[model samples]
Target: MWYSISNLLGFGADFGPTTAAGRLLTIGFWMLSLILIATYTAQLTSFLTLKASKSTITGIDDIKNNKVPHSRIGIVIGTSAEEYFLKTISQGSTNYYHLSTTQDIFIKLLDNSIDVAVASGASAIYAINNLYCKLTLVGEPFYATSIAIDLPRVWQYKQSLDVQILQLTESGELERISAKYFNTLTCGSSSSDESSSKKMEVQSLAGLFLTYACVSVIAILLHLWLKLKRHL
Candidate 1:
């Protein structure tokens, strides 16, 4: 039955269904295969076209292997990211361009002074969202660090502050605040724009559906002819 179904779908299985149920199943299989193949081919073409225009730098490995020219890599001085790159990536070598502030990172990138920049994930995402919509984060975080508030040794209300911080975190307020910053950095609206510009119409799949319908009609006719021949 499986071989007959495969053959009916033009898979060259060299068999035909011996039962009515098998013939019905073959028709269903053909319809399903047609839908799946059409959808996959359309989506794959769209994906490849978009990927070609996107940045080649996906992660830190690409950065390390490409060596993007030391001078072109920008880092804000006195930050954890700067320390990580210096100690781990550059091996204590002063190869990266030092920026005075996080904002400078995007400015230099836009002007083509720097090819890439390393900054705290929060600050980088915030900048990309609010200040520089054109800039994008390339890789997974290399040096993950917890953010903490500094308190003086003699400061009072330390316990109270800790309790409030815990309350905020537990209540999901901290997550909401972080999400507000990072969520805006996504190119969702841009994707919508592309989709709108290249919107698929019913006409786009008309030929595919037409071909399936024709094949279905032919299969039904053949089935009817065989049944009449058997009776004769």
Candidate 2:
């Protein structure tokens, strides 16, 4: 309500809940972590899905350059893709203009504010085949992550659930769901993008070198000006 209060008072304010804000927020993290763990155990993990409202774009290049652009790709915060994008694409900064939550990204795409959403390619294909065929999927997927269901770490009582998941997998029930949703028998292997890391490292070194050179030049100029002033 701080944002509301500030607006009422004619002052700009940010009201993000934080430790300073005194509201509990870790529950979301815990719940998400629990879900991931369950998926891991049951092997029914959720896949990330990228969706776009507009249909004209044809390929990943269009999405990366003309459509989504570096400053406008939307992704779920704290997700695997976000982490990879930061490390490989954004150099570990959380403030990439291209990134946002999956939902907000879709909304942005619908509003024509963003070009595309980055999500599980599997999920994207599913949406395209079953739901949003109007939007075209770009080139081959850039990466893939294993999908799994979250479960508690305890190995005793969850055995029954594990057995059930295995039974479903063997009975082809899980495969049916996969085919229905994913249009494939098995998920594709994740693409290996090592160039991103190498490029980031190179850029970081260049930035450091440039900063050091700039500071050195400034210091030399200042010293020279001070010495001449002393004589004058």
Candidate 3:
């Protein structure tokens, strides 16, 4: 049982099996090895053929330290993103260019008018995946906040609205709605194709193929030796 397990994992025994049961185990080992080899080859081939996208800037620090001028940093007017950057990144200075909408943010980026933009995580990701194919999101989220409905203090339906919102949240309706929008903006198919084309290279899988070739040659030689011994 131990020998079978060890061989199954590709750790061949030093001595040949002498008993019928041991030989059977050895056969099982060979079968497992062949399956593993085939599986690895297929995966390696796919990996070599796929490409990856590379981003120039990875985070807010990159934007801050980048030699790009301050005017190139875009911020949507009257947004939390704008407030956050003004208070934290820009240090109370209004050096960034102002834009009225999220669409304008991506348009400016595509035109090279803005080197970077401060916006909500969801908005940024949506634009990058759905609107601007060339844009990429990088780094961890800087500020964490909740999305909630705001109401005036004297609103008569506030209690009813709160109860309904709570019900939606607890019943998973809100999550489903959010997922619908997220799925639309994921951009999986296009990004995958673009990445596959960019990253894959023949040299990446050379080592895997070399190892497989060496193993195949050894197996062939062993089979020939066994055939000659049977005849003698």
Candidate 4:
């Protein structure tokens, strides 16, 4: 475990496997680590750079500034999001496209009728992660709001729950949880359609597992054979 962690972090290991089979296994592990790290780094960098591009309409501010025409923006009618857009973005004019449901966001986006969609960040993210893998968050959630479980006021465990949630965020468990659901790109376009990158699965490391299994069996068999030789 120490060796694996150190290798991934680029720290020099104090010692390495001495046996031939152990060395072979270590080599395979090194290769796997490199591939995993490279993929993660490349994708992270790509996302960050894309986030900075001016061509992308980022947040509510961009919409208010008319980066996309008001007619091209889709807002779910009768939603607080629509109200906010009307009051803040469109100056009380109902010129923006009225969408019937959150689902209309993706439908309008894909159909080329809308350049932007006004919906809760959570709803948009959920759609992007589960249903519409090609769709994505443009910027930090605007009009950020807190969501909470319905706990009784003066609840004794409230502090404890808050602490636990904060710990999850600080330790990156939240991001890991998010990644588990959001990692796949089943719906893709052109280049991504041809080659969608996915996290390394256990199946991809079958060769390494097979090698270790074979080595363990060989070692056991050799031990038994040596015992028989000594008896003879």
The prediction achieving the highest TM-score against the true structure is 1
What TM-score fits each model? 0.59, 0.45, 0.56, 0.43
- How should the candidates be ordered by lDDT, best one leading? 1, 4, 3, 2
Compared with the true structure, all predictions reach lDDT values of: 0.74, 0.53, 0.72, 0.72
Q: Which of candidates 1 and 3 is the stronger one according to TM-score?
A: 1
* Leading candidate by lDDT: 1
Model 3 residue pairs with clashes? 50-196, 51-195, 51-196, 51-199, 52-199
Candidate 3 wrongly placed segments (more than 4 Å): 1-53, 150-152, 183-186, 189-193, 198-232
Candidate 1 lands at a TM-score of 0.59
The better candidate by TM-score, 2 or 4, is 2
lDDT of 4 by residue, 88-149 (tens): 77779999899998888999988889888888646566667567765655665668645568
Query: Candidate 2 on 53-112: residue-level lDDT in tens?
Result: 224555555644545456556667767777777666657665544545455644666676
Error of 1 at 100 (Å): 1.2
Rate residue 124 of model 2 by lDDT.
Answer: 51
Give a tens-digit lDDT track for model 1, residues 88-195.
788898878989998898889999999888777586776675667677666667778777788998778998998999999999999999788766645544344332
- Residue 52 C-alpha lDDT in model 3: 32
Per-residue lDDT value at 6 in model 4: 72
Scanning candidate 4 in windows of ten residues, the lowest lDDT window is 188-197
Root-mean-square deviation of each candidate, in angstroms?
9.0, 26.3, 11.1, 16.2
Alpha-carbon shift of residue 53 in model 3 (angstroms): 7.8
